[model samples]
Target: MNGNVEVVVVGGGYGGVTAANRLARRDGVSVTLVNPRPEFVSRIRLHQLVTGSDDAVEGFGEVLGGDVRLVVDTATRIDAAGRRVSLAGGGTLSYDYLVYAVGSGAADPGVPGVPGAAEFAHWVSDFEGAGRLRSALDTASASASVTVVGSGPTGLETAAELAEAGREVTLVCGRVLGPSLHARVRRPVARRLAELGVTVLEGAGARVTEVTRDAVQLDDGRSLPSAVTVWTAGFRVPDLAARSGLRTDADGRLLTDTTPTSVDDERIVAAGDAAVMPDHPFRMSCQAAVQLGPAAADTIRRRIAGKTPAPVRMFFAGQSLSLGRNEGVTQFSYPNDKVNALSISGRTGAGVKEIACRFTLNKLVSGARKASSRGSHGDSGNRLETPQPEHPTTPHGTRRSA
Candidate 1:
């Protein structure tokens, strides 16, 4: 409305990066992205990073907008009243609008016998944890046993990666494997894990009661010999929002409306796993985060222009699971994320999964390039072209974070 509109995006994950890039497109808008690292963490591939298949990181230049200021620092607090963000690196950033996308990290339920076990257990929750797990796996004996807990995509991918690496692997599904998948779609996943030589245990009895240095005690009074225990059970969002007095869900995800604007403040918006859009929430998957990113960005733009932002339109295309480096499975699903009988497996399936990963990186880079030209020449009124799904029926996992 006046001078340059300052927008500060807290977090460098998929949602934050997308929002920053989109905001950079508007004339007279200044975008600053705050993250702990200069490089973007491709969280979807952290499992591959842990197995030495990929590094899972790239410089901001690869995806972030050229005009966007990159602040390599963690956000310690958000002052909504003052419209400033306190950083871990000892500074504060004032903003006209704040986009919160702090994201999540690994969590230990603190079950008995697991007080200081993070140091010992292999974890793939973050880059550092993935690195540690890589080192542990590299030095462990060939005969060492590895147990991966949780039946979510993360746990499934981790167990498959190690098993494909020829390690002795067991996937402990607390209740069932691929709980979100339809029984028909889950069938192929089970078959592939079997082919990979992974031991899959279902039922509550398979739940880990305690994690020791070299073993995981199951609920059924059984101690599994786990030379390396990789915990991919679940994720927990950062508490920065709740602590800042912002409205948040029970899990600490910022509570937002359809437009992803914070329920308590119109000047603040949120996206990614850290945002809980009431009744419209999806799992903490990259598929959902990417859409939320651009949607939240548009919300900020509209608000600044004295207009109401439209509801964020999110469609979950499908589930892409890489069983290993060479083989995988792509279970096609509806836009609602419900699985279908049609699917792809083996090398062909791996190809689709790899494309999904590349599409995300490419989307960010493309978004940045468009933002650069548009900001320089003024608004061209062209809609940003997002990648469409290959099959009209198969939902496309177009973009997002890990």
Candidate 2:
């Protein structure tokens, strides 16, 4: 753990960016972030991107630490034995430690076994997918019918955004709308969607059995005309970890211990949606990514100093849903992430959702600027504004949280 430490952070998403910034605050640490795109994508705004609300992209220079190197390339493989990362653009970078944060994206459309789902349905999960969806919408008739499959946060937001844009929309909820929210919150959300003129098909027999170029078939023998079908059913992580022969859960998430270190290699750690904390697994949302980012960095910083890495501590507050630009819903949950009776809706909820999105970007910028604070004040205790080990808790599972 000697002269200087070379840390290569794969994936420039929320977790990788925050981890790079925090790690760069310490002296004698060279942080290089490898990502396929040069700009930082604000994934939460992807739904907005589809409806021409927000482009959902920012320059890495605005959010990344000035000292951190940004490599615009995809990671092909991780050579753990050689401590090297092979890039898709050619050449390999050597690293003393690796941070795996290659976040998740839309799951395979073929997974549901619905015909034409993969070829016909559009997605809004990733940057390129959102752009493709936008292009498809732009070319399609404005009066054309739009159908959104799945009722997660993404589906709800996308359907609402499209409906507000004056698109004839139908929401085919696979099972229930806002399945993770408390019954109290779900009621308000359904009301808002109804007000937006969203045709919500819930309860049994609402699941889509087939997706065609012009319509969708339901399990209950119903055919809905869909000029443009959007599929946001599920998400899957990149196969880079599995491809590298690293230990991963069945979902292809990198398996880590309490300290967030890879069970196979001490020099490797994980964060974001790609990481699975078996003991305290949480959802795949920005909430978890921002917190886990600094914790992963803390682990690396401790190891570099020849100290034991501390265990990661995390919790959840609630779920935020933006039903178009004027209305929304916020469902409060216990620290354990169980939906409680507490809830908020209408304009107040919209304000909360907007503030949360703004705060996410601000948090990254603040973390990047912390390097100067380190020089002025020296490494202070818990410099990163990440969640601390105050009250460690776990969540039920993944659910929609915008």
lDDT of each residue in 1-402, candidate 2, tens digit only: 778899989998999999999998999997888888868999999999999889999777667776676766788899999998887755577889999999999988888688899989999999999999999999999999999999999999999999999999999997788788887788999999999999999999999888999999999999999989999988999999999999999989999998899999989988799989888888899989998999999999999999999999888898898999999888898887777989889999999999989999999988877753545443222121111123211112222111
The 10-residue segment with the lowest total lDDT in model 2: 392-401
Please tell me which predicted candidate would have the highest TM-score against the true structure.
2
| Candidate 2 residue 22 C-alpha distance from true site, Å | 0.2
The lDDT leader among the candidates is 2
lDDT of 1 at 400: 26
Q: Write the per-residue lDDT of candidate 1 for residues 149-243, one digit (tens) a residue.
A: 78788888999988988899999998889886667778878998999899999986887777788988888999899988888877888899988
lDDT of 2: 0.86
Task: Give, for candidate 1, the lowest lDDT window spanning 10 residues.
Answer: 379-388
Show model 1 residue runs off by greater than 4 Å.
Answer: 111-119, 374-402
* Per-residue lDDT of 59 in model 1: 69
Residue 353 shift from truth in candidate 1, angstroms:
0.3
CA lDDT of each candidate? 0.82, 0.86
